[model samples]
Target: MSFILFLRQLGLSLAEIKAILTSDYSEQTLLLNKKQALQEEIARLQALEQTIDDQLQQVNQQDTLQVDQPIHLRVLQRLPFAQDFDLSVVETIDWQPDWMLRQLYYVINETDYAICMATPAVSDYQIDAGCYVTTTIEAASGAEFDSALAAITTHQTLPLIGIEMRGTFLSPGKHLAVKILGNRKE
Candidate 1:
């Protein structure tokens, strides 16, 4: 005879029969439900892992492009002519191995002066001889100086340390406005 029928014949109430059946099967049902929940959680975590791997691949590809790009920096200011008729512009720049100095622009209010840049060398002497870039300015405009600097092909890549405008100025209140431009791989 069925368990439920046998229990009913023994004078068990309907609520008592239901309670016995539920207690007998409750452990198995609970274990099955827990297993199903765990499987769903594992599947969700696997999908998330796949998504993270795809994003990492994209970031690696972008990093390669970024390394080939060039970063440009410049410094611009007007310096007064000192009593020795030389305006000294000192700029201490720390350059990385990938840096490439591209161009230099200068706009002097006077026309007769020459511009030179010096840097510390590997020799015992602290200050190396300067490199002469330009000697005369036709105009005092920024655009004119930029154009002039662009035409010069002899400006080699050198370490920037100090800059000076040497020679006499035409007027008493004359000053020099200089711009240094460079590029580097990032």
Candidate 2:
């Protein structure tokens, strides 16, 4: 009904009504402070989350750059053959900045020389100068050695000398030397 009628029914004085209003205002002030504190906390957490996201993005970018640069393979040297000389490998690495030795692989000669010899060191295609790589192969001997002879006999190109690179990068235009030792039937 009317405010005055309601107060009259309750038999409250104006002074008592004023005191109730003051208590209500106090409760509202406490609630407002709690809401403000929560808002500040939320803002701080959001800022931290954004910082973490930025760091993650930077790490991903570095990973992408590394993907563009791959480790490759190349041959460094070969030596005169012994009767049963063990297989030897050679490698050359070409990195843009600085390269670590881990990029190269050394595979020993086995009966399955082709499979056992191929390593990540050798590129399927050519690599450029300044880029680096490694390579391993069974020294051409017996039938395999004769294969080079046959290839040379059939044409000027020596199939045994066929070289491949990882990509279209330029390679070192020189031959490398490596040594071998094992049982010989001479």
Candidate 3:
């Protein structure tokens, strides 16, 4: 019609002059590659949310301690040569030992149970460092075969390769405690 009115006075039109004569920048290079893949997926989810808040602040930091010693029912047999683990759940730990270890685990009074220990770590994997220990016991219900026969007439100084019979279900008094499970693996 006048060369489309001289290409609409030069502002072009006929489909922007056929997309600038075919050099069609694929819709602005697909919106700049979808805005650089959403800014690298928001910088890899903010570096995985700061690596899950620094592993939840290293499990909310811990270095607890609670001792007065008095409770009994011990057994770990031996651990001088080290290297042998199998805490085959002999159940009885209704969970309770975080309130600064329950106010010193209620000041060793007729302790229903508590025998947490750890130190092994010469490389066979690792554990030492703050090497832990928490004593307190009083069992009954098949108390894991009397704690493996009181680790052969007990006289320990921390040498009972194994004895996992934790407790916390007595909230009534008396004795007959139970939780004697087992495990094996040399």
Candidate 4:
């Protein structure tokens, strides 16, 4: 017999039958509540998954754009200077319209040394020698200081460039070389 009919036959009132069906520990009531909670949780997780997928798509698009861009590098100038030259003088450097100053590379053939470069009455700075020292003006101010040293130490290759070298401490017959590298957009 139907449960509701059985309850009616037992003389249970309508309110008592309803109370038993809707009680907290009833099997049907517990299963229905659990099913609703799981549905809600599934919806929340699906939304999170969609957000992550959107972010991944944006990253992939940026990567594709970067790969399509072309990078063109060229040697802007090659400057040679004496190992023991004074570095407090200023000079101007020439460049082509297509060339943009990007990086400076200092090649030391002699023993390691320390170098300094500064703008006249503006700033003073120092740099230590390595197999090669690289600097980029595109970076922060501190980074530009090192790049300026690499550019200026090689016979004032850039305008208003002044440099001083110390700790040459090289064995006899050692020398130094400096090269300036630049880039342009193709």
In model 3, pairs of residues that clash are: 76-160, 77-160, 78-160, 78-161, 90-179, 90-181, 141-176
- Please write out the lDDT profile of model 1 over residues 1-186, one tens digit for every residue: 486786676566899768867776564664576578778777667655644553453334322211222222233333442212222433423332212222222323232222222122332112212322222333355466546544432353433222222221323454443323222232
Candidate 1, position 87, lDDT? 26
Candidate 2 lDDT tens digits, 1-186: 474455445555788556755665464654576578778777667655644553453334321111224434443333333232233332332232212212222222322122112235655422223321212122334556434334333433211222221111222443222111111122
lDDT of 4 by residue, 82-127 (tens): 3332233212333322111122223332233222221123222222
User: After aligning candidate 4 to the native by TM-score, how far in Å is the CA of 140 from where it should be?
Assistant: 19
Q: How many angstroms is residue 159 displaced in model 2 relative to the true structure, after the best TM-score fit?
A: 57
TM-score of 3: 0.19
Model 3 Cα displacement at 136 (Å)?
22
lDDT of 3 by residue, 10-129 (tens): 455689756645775565664576578778777667655644543343244322222223223322122222222224332333333231222111101121223333222232112223
CA deviation > 4 Å runs, candidate 1: 1-25, 62-186
Off by over 4 Å in 4: 1-24, 62-186
Instruction: Estimate the lDDT of model 3.
Output: 0.35
TM-score of each: 0.21, 0.21, 0.19, 0.22
Model 1 has an lDDT value of 0.38
Better of 1 and 4 by lDDT: 1
Q: How many backbone clashes does candidate 2 have?
A: 25
RMSD of each: 26.9, 25.2, 21.2, 24.4
